[model samples]
Target: MILLVVQTLNGFQLGMLLFLVAAGLTLVFGVMNFVNLAHGVQYMLGAYLGVTFAQMAGGFWAGLVLASLSAGLFGLALEWLIFRHLYGRSDLDQVLATFGVILTLNEGVRLIWGSAPLELAMPRLLSGSFALMEGLRYPVYRVAIAGLGLAVALLLAAGVHRTRAGMLIRAGASNRDMVSALGVDINRLFRLVFGIGAMLAGFAGVLAAPLISVEPGMGENVLILAFVVIVIGGIGSIRGAFAAAIIVGLVDTVGRGAITGLAHLMLTGPAAAKVGPALASMLIYLVMAAVLALRPAGLFPARA
Candidate 1:
């Protein structure tokens, strides 16, 4: 039972991280109609930069701030140089250009950081564990991650609902031509959105750095999951992202942990071992397939 609880928390922490990455990807797709495969590279950049900054600044917070700022600035520059040219192009063009960016960034990181994985030390304040129940102690850092995810969700909701820029963003998502017709600077808006999206991805990377090894291609696997989150949540809907992230997180985590246990009861140990991870990995996609078959649009699509 305690093991179940710990796994549940771990799943939620992972989901929150996915939400951060998906939020940016969905937003960029929702508003700009651009398919950016390179967004994952921003996450890789964040993890890399965070480790470097932490080593230089000798603190977690300072490293996080620097990492996020650097990633955002990089996004802005990319937007100005590459994304700007592709905005008016077709989806295929956007995909190709972004793919190029990914190759360039991945190689750049390899050249600068080498092929070795970088390690990040968790902050001293969050390095300990707290008693959750009898004989159960959970890492404080996981709890901190969950808290940060919730905070980000609230801020995103408020931004979209109450803030002027969010209003513009929503409007743009629905009808870019109409929004542009209203004399809004769509280019500038895209730049801001891209920058924010990059920062969010970077923040997720930084948070995950200490938990996971920072290495080249670290973002690729997560990026695939983030896309699943976006698809389940609905491409343009923040609320949908939040709900889907939690659901996917719980399902994936719980399924991975429990499948083998359940399989062992029915099958032999070797069989269970072989089948468990495979089945667990497919669970979320199965959920996605079901959702697609039923709704087609998504669970919570942005208001039209």
Candidate 2:
């Protein structure tokens, strides 16, 4: 029971991280109509920069802040130099261009940091666990992450629903030409949106850095999962991304943990061990497939 509770929290943490990544991806996709495969590289950049900054600044918080800023700035530059050109191109062009960016960034990381994985030490304040119940304990850092994610979500919701810029973003999502006709500087708006998106992805990487190895191409797998979240939740909707991220996170976490246990009960230990990880990995994809089949438009499409 304690194990289950711990796993549940881990799942939630994972979901929160996914939300950060997917939210940005969905925003770029929904508003700009561009498919960016290189967004994941932003995440990789964050992790790398966080580590580098932390080493330079001599503190985790300073490193984190620096990493996020650097990532956002890099994103802005990419938007100006690369993504801006691909905006009006076909999906194939977008894919090809972004894929090249990914290749370039991945190689760049290797050149700067080498191929070795860098580790970010957790802040001292977040290094311990707290009792959640009489018997169950949870990591304080994971709880902090969940709280932070919730706060970010609320802020994002407010930004989207209350701000004039957000209003334009939504309008652009539905009809870019119409928004442009209103005399809005669509190019500038695109730059802001892309920067924000990049920052969010970077933030996710920073949050995840302590838990995972910061290495070249670390963002690739998570990027795939983020795409799946966007597809399941709906392409243009922040609300959809949030919902889908949590669902995928929980399903992936719990499914892997529980399936192995269940398999052990029904089959030999070796067989259970082999099957558990495989099945757990597939669970989220299975859910995605089912959702796609049922609601081709997605769970909560942006209000079109």
Candidate 3:
């Protein structure tokens, strides 16, 4: 029971980070009808900027603010310079171009930060642990991360469902041409969505910096998981992304532990060790496949 609780909490933490990244990616994909293979770059930028700014400012809070703003601005610049030009191109062109951006930026990051992994010091306020039960003491920082993510998710949900900007975003997602005909500056909306998406991804990166190593290419794996999230949740659906992220996170984390324990019961020790991890790694993909097989359009498709 204690182990289950701990693993579940860990899953939630991972899910929260995934949600932050996937939320933005889904918004951009839905609103712009564009595939951005380079979305991970913004995440990498966030972590790097968060660490640099924090070190320079000598304060974690200040660094987070500065890094988020910088990330948003950089995203805007990318949209204006590269993404805007590709809006009308084929998905193949968009994918190829953005993939180039990924390669360029990855190399740029290597040149700037070198190949060494960097670490962000945890905030002083959250650098301890608290007892969650008689036998379990959980890290305060992890709880804070989960709390922060939940807060952000709530705000995002409200913004999408209640605000006029959100309504415009929704309308644009449903039919960009129609929204444009109705006098909406679809291009401006695209920029706004893209910028917001980038900022959210950056925010995730900042939050994750302390927990994981900040290094070049760190965002690639997260990006793949985020893609799985958006796909499983239904492309362009924020709610779907949230649910899917949590599902993926839990399956990936808890499944590893659970599957391994079960494997030990059924197989030799060495075989179980090898097979357990391999099966656990495939859990999320299998879930995605199941969801797609049933829903085809995803659980919460934007149109639905």
Candidate 4:
């Protein structure tokens, strides 16, 4: 019972993190009608930047703010230097170009930070564990991460649902051509969306740094997961992203334990141990497939 409770909390933490990364990616996809395969690298860069800036400023908060802003600016720069030209290009071209950017950035990260994984220092205030039950304890930092992520999610929801800019974002997502015809300066909107998305991805990275090893190509797997998130959530839908992200996180985390236990009931311990994880890893993809089969637009598809 205790293990289940702890893992559920862990699942929520994971879901929040996934929400942060997927939020930005979905926004960019929804508004720009562009494919950005390089988006995950922003998350990777955020972790690296957080580590560097935290050491330089001698504090975690300072590092988080600076890294997020830097990530946003970096994204804008990429938009101007490379992505702007590719906006009207074919999706294949965009994918190829962004894939190249991934290779270049990964190599650059290696050259600058080296290939070894780096760890971020947990903030002093969140450095201890708190009892969740009579015998179970949980890390304060993990709780903080989930709390912060949820706060961001709420703010993002409000911004998208209530703000004028958010209205434009939704409008753009629904029909960029129509939005442009209405004198919306679609390019500027695209830039804003892209920058914000990058910042959000970076923010996720900063939060995840202390919990995971910061390494080269770390974003690749995350990028794949983010894509899964957007697909299952529904492209161009923030609400979908949020709901799907949480569902994915909980399913993935809890399924691992449940599958293993079930396997133990039917197979040898060692075989169960081995097979459990393999099946667990497929749970999210299986869920995604199931969702797609039933509702091709996802659980909460964007309004067209």
Return the top candidate by lDDT: 3
Select the stronger candidate by TM-score from 1 and 3: 3
Give the backbone clash total of model 4.
0
Instruction: Compose the digit string of candidate 3's lDDT tens values, residues 1-304.
Output: 8788889999999999999999989999988989998888999999999999999999888888889889999999999999999999999999999999999998999999898999999999999998877877788999899999999999999999999999999888778898999998999889889988999999989989998999999889899999999999998988999999999999988988899888888999689889888888888999999999999988898975
lDDT per residue for candidate 4 within 175-215, as digits (tens), equals 88888999988999899989999999999999999989999
Flag the better candidate by lDDT, 2 or 4: 4
Comparing candidate 1 with candidate 2, which one achieves the higher TM-score? 1
Model 1, residue 248: C-alpha shift (Å): 1.6
lDDT tens per residue, model 1, 27-144 = 9998898899999999999999999999999999899999999999998998888888898899888989888888888888999999899999999999999898787778899899
C-alpha lDDT of all candidate models, in order: 0.90, 0.89, 0.92, 0.91
lDDT of 2 at 183: 98
Number of clashing pairs per prediction, in order = 0, 0, 0, 0
lDDT of 1 at 3: 79
Q: Clashing pairs in model 2? A: none
**Candidate 4, which segments miss by more than 4 Å at Cα?**
133-136, 269-271
**Per-residue lDDT of candidate 2, residues 27-137 (tens digit):** 899989999999999999999999989899998899888888889999999998888988889999999999999999999999999999999999998999888778766
- How far is 284's C-alpha from truth in model 2 (Å)? 0.8
Candidate 4's TM-score = 0.96
